[model samples]
Target: MATHRLTELPADALKMIATIAGPVHDVEMVSAGYNSEIAARLHLDNGTVFVKGLRQDHPRVWTQQREADINAFTQGLAPALRWEIRKGGWDLLGFEDLGGRHADYSPGSPDLELVLQAMRYLTSATPPSGVELKTMPQRMIAHVTDPADVRFFEGSTLLHTDWKPDNVLIVDGQARLVDWAWASSGAAWIDPALWVIWLIASGHSAADAESLAALHPAWDITPVRHIDAFACAQQRLWESIARADRPDEWTHKLHAATQAWVEHRG
Candidate 1:
């Protein structure tokens, strides 16, 4: 989908944003995401604010609302939500501009350590009250070969399953996570397990990636049985996605990596 610049927003929508964000003197479209139709930084007199949205009629329109809801509970982990608006046939959200670079997880990089620190802190967080999020077990029920493997992921900790380098921002020597579309409630260990795949993709050996993740308390204490279950489940899930009618190159790469990780588990 083509991303829309702020100037492209209808006059009413621009007025609504200006009201909440101060007079917008400039607009810069952000090209990092795939789903957003309108993602930009509005330069107000006071400061820059990040905005992301999509057409109201889009099939995944509900994701914008979900991100807003999740943002309310993401105090320390993600940028704060400045406001949410549904105007001019669009549903948009404004967030505090976290001026930082995306984290790098390659071997010998310092950013990986900071990311682990953030993940450790995240494991201690309780989900905010009154918000509905899918449980990891619920989300993965269809992917695992054995029904019992689902129990391995049943827990109360909030999980950030997507660990691509693009989702983590490094600022002030700390790693701040972004993109809450896939946030779910699950065992704390599940997040570290998910990161292992990205770590490998970043050129770390499987053993080294496991070692880096082991620095987290959650990863250290994860039961061997549970780890085995999750490994097999992820392999099955990626296999199905990569083998689907017409899989893309990225999907095939991930499928192969997951398969290697599963074999490494043995």
Candidate 2:
């Protein structure tokens, strides 16, 4: 999903933003979002707020509500949500502008530690009561090679299943997770397992990536077979993604990395 400039927003949407955040002096369109149609830093008379939104009729528009509902639980590990605007056929969310660069996931990068710290913090979180969340098994059922492998993905811990570097920002020595669209309830070890693929894609070998993931306490307690099941599931997931679309370069890289990890597990 390509990001759109603030100017491209519906007139009523802009009016709604101005009404909520005061006059907008400038707009800096964000270039790093996949799920948002409008992602920008809106400079208002009062202050700046990072706003992201999608048309009300978009297939994934519900993600806006998901992010809004989950923000309370992500207080320290994620930027705070300030306000929400639903008007003119769009659902926009305003978030505190926590300025930071994406974390470096390459081998030996110091940012890896901060990323792990953020993951550790998330390991203790449980799904908020009354807020429906997809479980890992539900999300991965279609992709797992064997239906029985789905059992390995079940658990009650809250998870930020997407570990792409772009989703993690290193701010003042802390890694703040952004983009909660794929957040799920899952086995704690599954979060670390997901990170292994990103670490591998970012230049770590399978052994090194798994070693880094092992630093998380959950990884040590998870049975080896469970980890193997996840690796195999990831391989099948990426392969299906490739077959479904003309795989992008990064997707190819991830697919290869997933295959490597699966083979390493075997």
Candidate 3:
């Protein structure tokens, strides 16, 4: 079973958002990202939107503004925004929740087509001018990876910094990429690289994930190579947060398994 911890927004903050959103029931915070909060379905009676608080320290927060701004200015591209409030460290972003189901993509599964279709559209669309990766390379590398090979991926006009099944949902056989916090100026390969890694982490066999990554010819390096380099970035992070001291037989074994896989690849 997957364990997900959620945080409830403060009372004052709740009312502050209700002022603009109208009626709301409750909200839950995700464990992965500090400032991201998802309001439940019941809370969205007439209409409700996903709310994300910005953090100055977070590299992707600024790109979120770019996403909102892009969606506001363009048509039929990104999730539509209702309003943006200038809060202290980060702004409050409220966007209409587009109805979608948690995407289930795996090796040899057609669900991947949904992700690919969306990838094609996003890479095809033009992003706003004067945009670059706001996240520091070192820190970004720390979270996922910063292989020397990744330098070849720079110079993309518009790219989603992060992409994974959890960050995407399917609606009417099409994929909608959410969680724009990682939007950046890198090449298109960066987004798909992130998605391939998620596939491997979520129980898909390594060979299968590698095949999926290779399907995208636009990417400079093969998905398998990039996945190997970046795999430690996320696995090490989980161990750090859980404060794992050693490898166990079952749960902490995840770290052990990751290590084994890394060694096998090397």
Candidate 4:
């Protein structure tokens, strides 16, 4: 998973980007996520645009197309997709430049409020017609200890299940979500449930994380059984991921937080 600086892209790829975004005067690589081989802010004479892409033959190349397809239906929470192109063995996407800092999920941080606001808005959204997204039950079927546990995740709410703090940006006092690669259609409560794990990873106690999750309207009225089931299912899911990937320190921290939530629920 080596990263490619803007300059390293082949002439054909640069030509394709220039065709849509005008000449690139400068390129600043975004060092955040690892999925992209090329991710950076391209500074043009007129303005800046964020570009991300990967090798066309990569197994996860479809995620590039998926992000573009879902961006149109994400309302304003995600940056608008400007264009997508295939060039020089790469699939690339350009997005509106949102010059913002990654969200801070630590307890008592004001960014927490903004992130919750974005989550609440997202929970109310219905996935646009003809978008074939996997339902939560289908997604969790492999992770849940009991197949019946997956039933709690079944619903039509468009859930952004990846709650990594870096995926959220606090721009102009509003929270904007990025990296829609894992977006799924699921129960409204699922997002908050996922956020609780992140909150814990950011140093909030399990009780405080649950308290923060309470800010979401959907979480307030969810059945206790469903909550418990989801907590158990997510713990199992993260545990499997941790075991399989042997992720880095931060991911292991989040997995530990998920385990704490499961114990708290028990």
RMSD to the native, candidate 2?
1.7
Top candidate (lDDT):
2
| Distance from true location, Cα of 89 in model 4, Å | 1.3
Off by over 4 Å in 2: 1-7
Worst 10 residues of 3 by lDDT: 33-42
Leading candidate by TM-score? 2
Candidates 2 and 4 compared: the better one by TM-score is 2
Those runs of model 3 whose alpha carbons end farther than 4 Å from true positions after fitting are: 1-6, 25-45, 54-67, 70-77, 87-90, 135-150, 220-266
lDDT of 4 at 155: 89
| Number of backbone-clashing residue pairs for each candidate, in the order shown | 0, 0, 0, 0
Residue-level lDDT of model 3, residues 1-266, one tens digit each, is 12222366656656667777777775645444322533333265575577766444454456556656666433454567777765545456777677777678655666787787777677665556654434324334545554564454455446665564566768777777666655666556656655655666666665566567556655545455555555565466546644655432333544544454455456
> How many pairs in model 2 have backbone atoms within 3 A of each other, for residues 3 or more apart or on separate chains, i.e. clashes?
0
Q: Estimate TM-scores for all models.
A: 0.91, 0.96, 0.69, 0.94
TM-score of 3: 0.69
Note each model's CA RMSD in angstroms: 2.5, 1.7, 5.4, 2.0
lDDT of each: 0.82, 0.88, 0.57, 0.85
Candidates sorted by TM-score, best first = 2, 4, 1, 3
Residue range 23-83, candidate 1, lDDT tens digits: 9998887767555777788898988998888789987787787788888677888999988
lDDT, candidate 3, at 212: 72
1-266 per-residue lDDT for model 4 (tens digits): 22333445556777889988899888787778756778888899889999999889987887788788899889689999988888778899999999899999988899999998998889778876777677889988887878987888888899888888879999999999998887889889999999999999899999999999998999878999998888888888778778764476776887899899988887
Worst 10 residues of 4 by lDDT: 1-10
